[model samples]
Target: MTELVALVPAHDEQDGIVATLAGLYRQSLRPDRIVVVADNCADLTAEIAERCGAEVFVTSGNRDKKAGALNQAVPAVLDTLPDDALLLVQDADTVLNPGFVRCAVDALDEDEGVGAVGGIFFGEEGGGLLGLLQRMEYERYALEIHRKGNEAVVLTGTGTVFRARVLREVRAARRAGRIGGGDGYYSLASLTEDDEITKAVKTLGHRTVSPDGCWLVTEVMPTLPKLWHQRMRWQRGALENLRDYGLTRVTLPYFGQQIMLGLGAVALGLFAVFTVIVLVTVGWQGFSLFWTAITLIFVLERTLTVRGAGRRAVLLALPLVPELLYDVFRQLVFARSLVDLVLRRQEHWVAT
Candidate 1:
């Protein structure tokens, strides 16, 4: 039997830690041990985790954030487990469905070349407009991952399972100066360590997959500003990770896709600004049939894409203008992220 252990890196997550632990306890395939790394928590995070029966390791003098905390905690417990043991890294605020672990384990067991498996994340319900929008976004994201099958370019941090030996190999490579070095298995330089590790795993000739049945629910940002900052870090972090690894034949298409999307967003923004200028100066005569057709096509595409979001999503889609506005907002966020990346601006992690 393959031994399984879970590592949760948390910082001031007192309110959700108990529920997270309970969710794991109720898994169809339970792990042998659950370790919670309480990094610089001012609340009852450590206390709650201990009360819930998790082995807690409180981090002191570890200022590298989630990556650093995981680095410190994972090796300590992982050293005791066998090479074939599975290591699961889950977010403090996430709740996995009972089948999640079972599905993830099956995925890893299915292929010797598969190093990691990430879960499809569905946003928790009820937060008003922002929440609904985020839920819709997650639906689309999950759908895409399912359609992509076993090939996952980016492994999400919400919940991911890894083969212990693969992680040990990654750690060895880091120590040998083949990859960037940090405190542990994960690197602290990138804003999104999960993305960085995904690239690393691929470089070692192992595939990272996400199975549709392995899904979890997580909290979504309740406001526009919060969502903006969260996405900004993600976008910039992706860029940094790619830059660090240097583009290869396998990564070229992925990089190209992102560049194309960013360029398209810039084009759309300029067109929108031009259309507004024309409307203000030349009245109704300035309206172009070409732009109208393109707008309708985009609205239809977005509406169809979000159809899985339920009745409320349908109602939200009924107003095509708002959906278009939201797309513009997303485009602007991506654009800003590119600018920040070019300027070499540093973005710190903030729990969302």
Candidate 2:
């Protein structure tokens, strides 16, 4: 039998930690060991993890961030791990499907070269409008990864599994200066360690896997303000990591994916607004053709995304303006992230 360790890095997540650990306890293919690294927790995160049957380790230091927590825990867990064991990394706010562990382990067994595996995350129960939007956006991200087929660059940390040997080899390579950043240390001068580490794994010619069967239930920010913070931090971390790794060459796809999508959508929206302005300024006949075309495109796109999210999501489509407004938020977030990256601004960890 293969041994598996589920490593959860948590800080001040008292409210949701127990539920997440409970979910892990209910997994079909139970892990051999469950370790929770509680970094500078002011709440009951450590106690809850221990109560839920996780072997808890508390870290003390100024480096209380997620990366720092992982750095402390990974080494300890690896010390006692079997040669072919699996290391599953999870966020404290995340819950998993009953079969999540089995699915991940099976995927790793099937693919000899697969270094890591991740699954889709369904949003937490009970959500408001903002929460719903965040869920849709997250689903869109998952779909993109799903459609990409086979190897993915980064595995979502919410629920990711790494082969023990593969991760050990990655650590060795990092210590040898074969990989640039985040070899041994988790918080390596950048705000985003996951992105950097996954890229490094790929650099070593190992594949990151995402199987269809692996599933995890995760939470989205419950409020708008929280959503904004979440996006801002995520975008900033991404941009900062990109800069630190000198990976500008690979940024074209990211730009094309985000910027082009936003620009094209917003451009059509602006064209519609301008056409309406011209019609009111002159006569309806002046810009009728342009207005009709732009309106049709806008409606079609929203309808598609809404319908794609299913019947419940389609109801929210009534307020067509929200989609347009979301684009504005996206632009702001991206712009701020760019500025922060350029200025070398540092961001502290904050829960969304």
Clash number for each model: 0, 0
Q: For residues 299-344, write the lDDT of model 2, one tens digit per residue.
A: 7666566454566566665567775577677777777777776786
Off by over 4 Å in 2: 62-64, 150-153, 182-185, 247-310
Best by TM-score: 1
Clashing pairs for predicted structure model 2, backbone only: none
Q: In model 1, what is the error at residue 123, expressed in angstroms? A: 0.8
TM-score of each: 0.93, 0.87
> In candidate 1, residue 186 scores what lDDT?
95
Candidate 1, 1-352: lDDT as tens digits: 9999998999999999988999999999999999999999999999999999999998879988888888888889889989999999999999999999999999888888899998888989888987888888888888888777756767788899999999998998888877774636998888889888988888888998988888899999988888888887788888887788788855686699688878889788788899799879887785579988897787787788888789888778777766667777788878787788888776777766
Q: Show the colliding residue pairs in model 1.
A: none
TM-score of 1: 0.93
Give the least accurate 10-residue stretch of model 2, judged by summed lDDT.
247-256
